[model samples]
Target: MARNREKEDVESRFNPPVSISMADSSISLLKLISILIIFVVGVVIGLVSSSHIDRYFTFQGDEFNFKNTYFDTEQFSHDGQKMVVNCDGEDCLSMESFVRLRNLNHRLRDDELFWRASFVPQKEELPFRRVPRVAFMFLTRGPLPMLPLWERFFSGQDVEKYSIYVHALPGFDLEVSNSSVFYRRQIPIAACRMGSVSLVDAEKRLLANALLDFSNERFVLLSESCIPVHDFPTVYKYLIESIHSFVDSYDDPTRYGRGRYSRRMKPDIKLADWRKGSQWFEMHRALAVKIVADTKYYTLFKKYCKPSCYPDEHYIPTYIRKFHGALNANRSITYVDWSQMGPHPATFTAGNITEGFLESLRNNGTRCSYNSGKTSICYLFARKFDPSALEPLLNITAQVMGF
Candidate 1:
């Protein structure tokens, strides 16, 4: 009996004993199961993340739908330069043609065929943010009645980190008094007609005028009439750093953007050169400079991006499509309510500007769950607000800025 017990005790000893291999096998099995479970969890997380990345970061051309409706009659320049333009925008001269302009003309007029550097930032200068500075380019024909609201938003600390450029109408004669933050900041501007070449010219002029001194990394165009739906800092970061711009559109040809300015552009004057949209837009600085200083396309656009044709709606997006198609965030940030088809956007009446409406506008047709805040889309500013609607907006400025 004693000899049998001794043998069993000896067999049960795992350390350097007969059962060592069995213990090792059990340990290996547990490790294998743990590894399998961890891998499955990792794959699930990766799949979900990838889906979100694909949805938001990926570019979709749906928002860039503007097209040329018509072109001008064959015409000549003041120097007897005959320009026979095609009305069908499909005839647009390739953007490659402009490459020759920067090389040849040295200024789009040079053989190299390109405009002077307008929005390009210096490589050495540190960006205003670790990302970029947002240039709030305000296009307005009236006083900034909401200056009090704007003043509170800026709040003074590190103000130099950002830039503000106002394009006020030559007629408005906006005073640049010390009392006015806008004082001395006004760039030469013109009144915009509903559908006119003057509007395109004005946009270009604003680009040119803004480029003369300020060289921000990003350019955000806003109307004087528009108001911030969120805090300035929050909106500022969004406009300057976010890769996607807020101009909205679906893929439907009927509903897509109307940018059609390629053929109407001068040397090739085809009916094809027409595009259209709201006068307001936000863009990277490189694009801003490209539009403002363009020589070849500008000449063509001047000829075809006409007042009678409503150039404001066409020029910018069309040029962007042709010249720097990839760089545009493919969106506009300013909000204009044109729910009803009409020449004018729906203006916000005091009655129409309820808290619910303001909430909706601030949401910018996007939800802001914790998971989506990084990509949460919203409009920075909204336009056509009745002077009376200003009161309601002020009441909720605090909440709007947070999300």
Candidate 2:
């Protein structure tokens, strides 16, 4: 018996029993590894599922009644300049164009683009003539009364040569004929009251919409009251070929100019930089892009240039003068007769319509310097024509305006 006990004790010492704590720890480790693997698998599956869903929607343009809408990065590249849709499904150019324009609002808010508003580098000159178009932006309270005249003006111009964008008052319906140039070209607009920050906002909104078309080389801001004084060819040649933009920026010692400067705009916009001019303007693509991208000067104006300041008159003039003074002609091409005015310019009645009056606005019996020492016709547009004058003007359109 004693010998058996000693042998058993020796066997026990030689081969130690497994520990309970160690066994529990090993099981726990295995369980943790299993859980981790399941989690990883779930995450991978989720990502793949999300990707599949995205692909499904992207190619399902046909499901939404869109045709010839195969996905191509080329169409949407760089502000959608080359965008085309051969739609057998829906009229993509009508509502979809606005969608594309609205999408640009998101890109405009990008931190990189918004902050880098000071300047953009010039693109390399290509051998091919990628002739860019002009965007004619009309800001109106409702329907354009001058639509017939504008239609006559735009009749012969190629469809690719220009684009029209309108910002009418929200909820104001405009009944336009399908043949009208301004038809279905309205952008989503916020409320805009004249002589307020809203007016500046409207201008910016117009510019932003125009900037979406990378092919738009120039932008012209027109009011409902504005009318073309020059023929389409002459107007196109003057605006498209001109090196400098037409933006009147001048020092006015009068109450309407320098006196309108707000003390709150100090440091960034000083009294020296404050200027006043007609709200009508025409700018090259570079300047237009800069205007849309601007936050520094725009923010300052929004904060300080209230009703008394007439922000529309001062904001653009001051901003362009401060940063891009050299690029402008320092005079508005849109003529306004401020001589007979209260807060507005003189409005022409039907009786005021005449060949001699139109000629006078175009020539004014004097020459203005253009492109540095080259004297030429000064004005391109005239404003504040009454709606009643449309017929009388149309009566003489072909004979007087050469349209």
Candidate achieving the largest TM-score: 2
- Write candidate 1's Cα lDDT for 1-403 as tens digits: 9999998888667446547778999999999999999999999999999998786654332322222223343353566567554444433553433211111101222211123434354576643324345666777767876666666666663555556666666677666557555556665454666556666666666555444334356666777667777776677667665654443222223323334334435454433433445667877666676676666665665665555555565566566655565565555567787888886788786677666777777775664322224444546777877677666667666665542
lDDT of 1: 0.58
| lDDT against the true structure, each candidate | 0.58, 0.81
Which residue pairs of candidate 2 clash? none
What digit string (tens of lDDT, one per residue) describes model 2 on residues 1-403? 9999999999888876679658888999999999999999999999999999998987685555443354344455586567554443232445445323424323344344334333444657643345578889999998789988999999979877788988889998667887877777887677988779889888888887777665678899999999998888888888898899999889999887888888888898899999988889999988987887877888898888888888999888999999999999999899898896587789998999998888888789778878867665899899999999999899987887799
- Weakest 10 consecutive residues, lDDT, candidate 1? 98-107
Q: Estimate the TM-score for candidate 1.
A: 0.60
lDDT of 2 at 180: 78
